[model samples]
Target: MNTFGLVIGLITLAVIGIGAFWVIRGERVLGYLWWPYFIGAGVLLMVTSGFIKNDWCSALAGVIGASLVWGATEFKEQAIRAELGWYPFGNHKKRPPFAKIIQKWKPPNL
Candidate 1:
């Protein structure tokens, strides 16, 4: 059992926990603070893919970076779902900050 692999798995789990927290609380915070994060992650992905000595580390970076990019799309859909009243908005005990952002985000009509 490679320790590096174990470390990577732990880091991935951490990412999942953080990402889930972000998703559950609300993606508006993410949207408001976007671009820099995804861009940095992309750069990190490329750098790790090229410079990392460990295969697991490089692969982990690539996966994480790609997931971040994909997460943007998922976040958008989550916003849409929230607008459509499909998903629970923010914490179950509190009202979501939906009016602040989603009100201004009108989806294109088909």
Candidate 2:
């Protein structure tokens, strides 16, 4: 069980690294490449169900599965933003709620 958990953790790390690299490369992987993450999460869930006797394994599996889903979402958001030409972190007029926060941190140029 411990070895299984370790393997899952390593796989999760690999997914994260690959996802991040794609993002950095500006390849727009997020818009259409989300299914592998779904498969990973589904597998984890299916495996965890059989690990009921090992509470620790079950819990770790759930957490790892959820994290993979979240990672896919992150990639998807970036992809959609790229497709739409929307750069959330890029230059833009500050909106209402954030405007006030920005004003507080204004530099000399502002």
Candidate 3:
């Protein structure tokens, strides 16, 4: 409906799309890249929103965009786990309960 709203909507879609692409590529890559891209997209959406207006398109876009990206992330994680036969949900706790497999990383002595 308004100029800013349209921009926000487009930005949100772009964010979601990029996240999807990352997911489709694989979760390890997505996990490494998703958060930054998501944050950047959210900021851009809010900036383009300027002030809330009649078209709630930006809000809707934000919601859908977040969901899409998050869903993609989850999917990618699961896929990686499945591919590796490690855990159905990687280290997500809720799935493939493998807490015993602790990975302790200490900084090398300098």
Candidate 4:
């Protein structure tokens, strides 16, 4: 019986749960402007995972990367939720570099 698939699925599930928390917390602390950075890092991790030889390591990296990507997309929605009083809103969010430029671009949605 191959338990590899089961283990990977569980890990992915856990990452997804964590993703939700981070999306809320991250948007509050870091702001939605950080979405581009999250997507970049997630894609970097996913591409790096291809070079990993160990099956478990590679799978874990890929799962985490995917979660980050998903979380990036959620940042915009999370920000809206915060504005709507659904979540805690932070008055001082850390802005990313090139804030002016990033503000001109629309954030990606799922």
Best by lDDT: 4
- CA lDDT of every candidate: 0.57, 0.51, 0.48, 0.94
Ranking by lDDT: 4, 1, 2, 3
Q: Which residue runs does candidate 1 get wrong by more than 4 Å?
A: 1-29, 32-36, 90-110
- Residue 84's lDDT within candidate 4 is 95
lDDT score for residue 35 of model 1: 31
For all candidates, the clash counts are: 0, 0, 0, 0
Candidate 3 — which residues are off by over 4 angstroms?
Answer: 26-73, 76-110
Per-model TM-score, in order, reads: 0.50, 0.36, 0.34, 0.98
Rank by TM-score, highest first.
Answer: 4, 1, 2, 3
What RMSD value applies to candidate 4? 0.6
- Please report how far candidate 2 places residue 2 from its true position, in Å: 21
Candidate 1 lDDT over residue span 1-110, tens digit each: 56976887788888767765565444544442243345456567767676878787777777677556555445656666765777555433322346455436543221
